[model samples]
Target: MTETLQSLALSIIELATFIFVFIFLAAIVWLIWAYISDIRQKKQAIRRNFPVIGRFRYFFEHLGEFFRQYFFAMDREELPFNRADRSWVYRSAKNVDNTVAFGSTRNISAAGEILFLNCPFPTLEADAVPPSAITFGEGQARQPYTTSSFFNISGMSYGAISKPAVQALSQGAAKAGIWMNTGEGGLSPFHLEGGADIVFQIGTAKYGVRDDQGQLSESRLRSVAAHEAVKMFEIKLSQGAKPGKGGILPAAKVTQEIADIRGIPVGHASISPNGHPEIKSVDDLLNMVHRVREITGKPTGFKFVLGAYGFLETMLKSIHERGLEFAPDFITIDSADGGTGAAPQSLIDYVGLPIKESLPLVVDKLIEYGLRDRIKVICSGKLITPASVAWALCTGADAIVSARGFMFSLGCIQALQCNKNTCPTGITTHDPDLQNGLDPTNKAERVAQYAQKMVHEVGVIAHSCGVREPRELRRYHAHIVGDNSFSTSLELLFPTRSVKPEYDKRK
Candidate 1:
């Protein structure tokens, strides 16, 4: 009887334990289902008012937007963008206070610290230069229009940016007295709307006006140059995004209107040739530059990113041989760190030299060749901040051009969704609904305001450095940190005089 009682007690304990476990698991399952149901209900509520779907549209629309924005998104930003960046752009463009409430979302003691230089005795304000009406290469024969703005938009094709966006940029730039870069997409009617000075860029593909054999057509070139607003022309050797790679505009964005303006087919993937088909050698490039200069009667320049190749020396030699008259009017150096609408990760992260290293070498090379005075150098690629711009000015750049910063001024949220068609701020997108959100009139005014503010701040920085003009900025103004820390490159790089004129050999 004792043995039987012990067996019954063990059986009862085992059964009771099993029952308890089973009840606990069921409760957990019930909670999980309830949580999932709540999420679905919230999504349904958010998407309910979407077009073409009734109440059911709410559940599916947000679901669709989520899928499209997250999974199906072709690396673009969707609606309900990040609050921090977008808010700053909106406020800056509108000339409103960019001060945020409470403390910054940043960790002050973090590893990457941005140190601002405090002035012991800040100077009083001076009469500011108006944004509009300036000239570069004034004493030189080949001069381009220069505005006083520290920030100006970079080259982006018309098809890449919507008509309204282009119109707004043109109007804004005009009001601010800054210039607009008519990207390789070709000059369009909207580019003329605001009468902004234009920098006509000729890409490797020669899209605007190519002959039947895909050669540069003189008539098309003349037609564009004939426009009174065409202030200068830029031969795009390569961009910062993919210095050696060609341009790629997807077929979806290539609408019939775009095709008509760009003189290309509507359905095909428009890929610019990797190099200029007509330009095979350095001489060919200089000849083309002169040809454009002669045709347009304006400054002609080329944009390129340096890749430690010996060809630059050879190219400079050719320029020397060709004589000063045949040399390009200007050279725009793009750093590897430059922004792009879209690019391969490998090229962006790895290719080309950084501005810090490349700028000094190129400047030294020019100084060595005694050509520094002849050719104006415009530095691009990550020249957005005041410090960076000041560094460029001190190092040797004649002017600065900014693409991404201007986009920020135009309200780019930096969602890093540029290549996709669904940009919410209507900056990089082409969708009608998205584009409508960007009021060109208001946005244009904001562009001017932001340009003025940034320029003014830069001027303030220049004054603090004891320099009245941007050209007065010197390498002593900056400090670099890396393997070597706390020293300026001016003290390190150029121990000799400003113009070398002896190391001009081609090897």
Candidate 2:
């Protein structure tokens, strides 16, 4: 009888707890509805008179954005921007659902148009032939590097991006046959994973393998070049996102592991000098390039954001005066619109020339010097779609490098928390808790898959343009929108067929 009474008492207590929980949940739902209704009804009135609350409107508006982005929205239903593009990255990376639906969400009559390859009758399969590797320079100094499929991961430093993210990118690049660039953060073991081919970037800082005085160390550079996977070396003069201003990796994001990899003190932020102290003029830069090339015996290139008021023209003149038969193996032109890990709001919003405008200028300048064939041009900045890449190739760029698009592939929700080290998908975060969720092995395969799909799709586009390969795409292959009608972008930029530089030495 006593045992039965105790059991009864326990059941009663459990029932009361359940009732309380239900009531609490219902109250929360009602309160949320009431608040939303109240705000909607009084928003105009509050805006007119309540000065303090009006100021808070922006905060509330931004807060609503957060809720809509992470919680309230569905995977297939984000407005103005949806998850379809990112979903394609994830699907391609996993080698799943590589199919095209009947209709596009895009409006055909929109002002800004997206072009597609209308494969006349039948669709083409992925190309079987391997991309030919380009050999830069002549004789013993020559080095060969192959162009993998359409996709290649752009430079993001070990310090700027987490170790696991680096490891995953490295492993993925190896698996995909694409190359990876070591963005000015210096070399770390994470870059070695899966034995991916690497392009070691020497930035303004010259952080890794520096001399005692923190200058570019020839011996150290040679040692790095000797590594089998380090196929190329690039001199970074400036990046697209924030030209002139150097790269910065914040101290708060720098974990102990990052500190050791970059060889910096744990508490201080890693600051790159605005320009290379050793290289001041064009001649100095060329000489530095010669030394690096002579020491490494590998393909040497330079990356920059172009803003020289005839500085390129001057540089071309200097090359001729010096009797330098060859120029850089390749040149990466980053447009002003490119994304960065973090940057000043002013710089991000209003600095540098957009790629659409800058690409034609740089290409024309190089051609004017009669150096177009000798030097390859790689374009970066805002290449998000098949149409964009197609347009870039059509504009005289040898290749295109994508950054944010790949991050989307890694499932970045664009939480905009990359600088804070709180990226949701583990692509940019340093926190152990968040990173543990990103499985390198799985994510690496996804990277490979996405690369292959992008390449395949690009190949299809190439075929429709009546071109056998991507390299054949030229300015005339595409058209652009004008105020009145549609005309080729090339025609608009080059009014005449013989658009030579005003001061072409060849003339």
Among the numbered candidates, top lDDT falls to: 2
Computed on alpha carbons, the lDDT of every model, listed in order, comes to 0.72, 0.73
lDDT of 1 at 86: 46
lDDT per residue as tens, model 1, 95-125: 8885567777743344322223434654445
Q: Which predicted model would earn the best TM-score?
A: 2
> Which parts of model 1 are misplaced by more than 4 Å?
1-90, 98-123, 126-150, 483-490, 493-498, 501-507
Determine which window of 10 residues in candidate 2 has minimal summed lDDT.
Answer: 122-131
Give per-residue lDDT, candidate 2, residue 296. Answer: 88
* Tens digit per residue, CA lDDT, model 2, 254-275: 7777666655678688888889
Kindly state the number of residue pairs that clash in model 2: 1
CA-RMSD of model 1 = 13.6
Model 1's TM-score against the true structure: 0.76
